[model samples]
Target: MKYVMVFFFLVLSILSCRKNKKDLINNKIIYNELIREAKQFYRLNDYSKAADKYEKAFKLIGGINNTKDGYNAARSFVLAGDNEKSFNCLFELTKSELNYDSYDYIISDTIFKPLHRSTLWNNLISKIKDNKEKNEKNYDKLLVALFDTIFNEDQKYRKSIDSIKNKFGMYSPQLKKHWETIHRRDSINWKKVKMILDEYGWLGKDKIGKQGNNTLFLVLQHADIDSQIKYLPMMKNAVRKGNAKPTHLALLEDRVSIKLKNKQIYGSQLMSKPDGSYYVLPIINPENVDRRRAEIGLNNMADYLSNWNMTWSVSQHLKMIDSIERKKNDIDFK
Candidate 1:
């Protein structure tokens, strides 16, 4: 009777371990698959579906406290025009370890444009402010002022560019003059940014906070390719440490790569042909591009290309490039 009882207990323990291992594997698979699907939907601009999938991913991975998926779900909900769901996701985020710095993202991102006029938005901001310490609030105020200054300058630059485009048409001969003016203004802004970075050292998430970092990123996005390359390593490290979004870093990398005539790892930027057709800028490993993009939380290349009115097929693109290369060879041989 003693042996029988011991044997039964051993069997139960073995079965429990097996079950636990299986459950862990299943959970990991589901979490990864959900994130991939959500990114696909996001690339297709199906914000509602993206939000749903992200929420599911969050639940599977232990919710807002475990991952930043809830914040992404919130942004997607806003983009989908579901302010209520967006607010709910934000509320969930508030329960997590999110700090006053997250409030900066909530206020600065254009994704939350739909929620700006809502009472819920106001309440959330007020709640965040009230929860912060006095020193944090003062720092936040300073950050907000800097953000406002940069944002206003950006708005003016954009307005001027649009006015020029409207008056001269998109490809006008006189557009060069406007470009010169824009470049001059950009140079001045770049100088200001350099001074800030000299004092702040990249305006990292821990220093000036996320909003400040985002504002600096915006400035860098408009700067010359050399400037982007100089900061690329720091930005990459920040993304790896979860201090910055991978998508932003990917986009910047792609942009700089395109300018340098190098193959981009993430196909975030597109180029228009002379005939008005668009194609993704050169990609490094064209075959496994989507897989690489997925690893970094970006969407599938096909759907992302579709946004620029381009159809993506690896085989087809390869064939086209081959033909173009052959033609060039023929001309050179002659």
Candidate 2:
């Protein structure tokens, strides 16, 4: 019995070593195949298939550095609507001992946009943003990288936390209010709110005020309670002065696509705080779930003002745009 046990152990060890060797050889062959196929798949627009092969290749060979094969594999994942996977590939590649330009494709490509929604993507982005925050890079370099992700993911809070990190410290109340509206199924105009805040940190007095029935407030009003309270001593410096609205506007349009694609709309709205301070919030768009319903009345509400019935079809789809425009006009009225 003792002899049999010893023989069994010896055979098992031998098998294990052989298996490891076979795996290593198999990996080499698969890695070469991946390189060949990834390029072909990408050129043929078979992104999904290419992505699958890339993932398998990565599993077998681990990460390869400074090679078009790995880079193109990441690109295929992005084109395939799997940004998380693309990000993983790039992340692994970036960590390789070999140095390569991962940013090469990002500069000329739009494929990386979808990954802006991923948490992993945001974490990596912060590393990049950190460099900029320290003044090691220019605004164009930093902002473009930041904006690309947020814009592609439609800047939905559910998609990524970066947007929250970007503005929450400054606009807590507004951010909370926007979140509440989403919960209550009230009009949601966060996309527009983001634009206003991004361009002008806090809305100056000219952009907001108290009126008879409706009070006007800028992005500052939505600031987080802590920041609002914290900045009280430096109240005068809270607002940002710039014409960054145009850039925000461009991004806002893309965010609104999530709403417009479903043909949703909203009306003028206002929010109030315990301090008697009132704010007019931007419009809310429809949820992605509602947008995808094949039936019109499956979840339709009679009270809801759809795009076909609105003053402008585009307005129906963009509550954030409408709300900001309303606030803009209100500023003119004052």
Clashes of each: 0, 8
lDDT of 1 by residue, 48-85 (tens): 89988887877886766432666777878888888898
TM-score of 2: 0.30
TM-score to native of every candidate shown: 0.61, 0.30
Candidate 2 local Cα displacement, residue 290, angstroms? 58
Give the alpha carbon lDDT tens digit for every residue of 17-124 in model 2.
999999888877667666556656765678998888877777676555445566677789889887776776666554425333223224335457677666876575
Error (Å) of candidate 2 at residue 196 is 47
**For this target, which candidate reaches the highest TM-score against the unseen true structure?**
1
Off by over 4 Å in 2: 1-22, 62-67, 96-105, 116-122, 125-334
How much lDDT does candidate 1 score? 0.72
Candidate 1 residue-wise lDDT at 56 = 88
Q: Please report, as a residue range, the 10-residue window in candidate 2 with the lowest summed lDDT.
A: 209-218
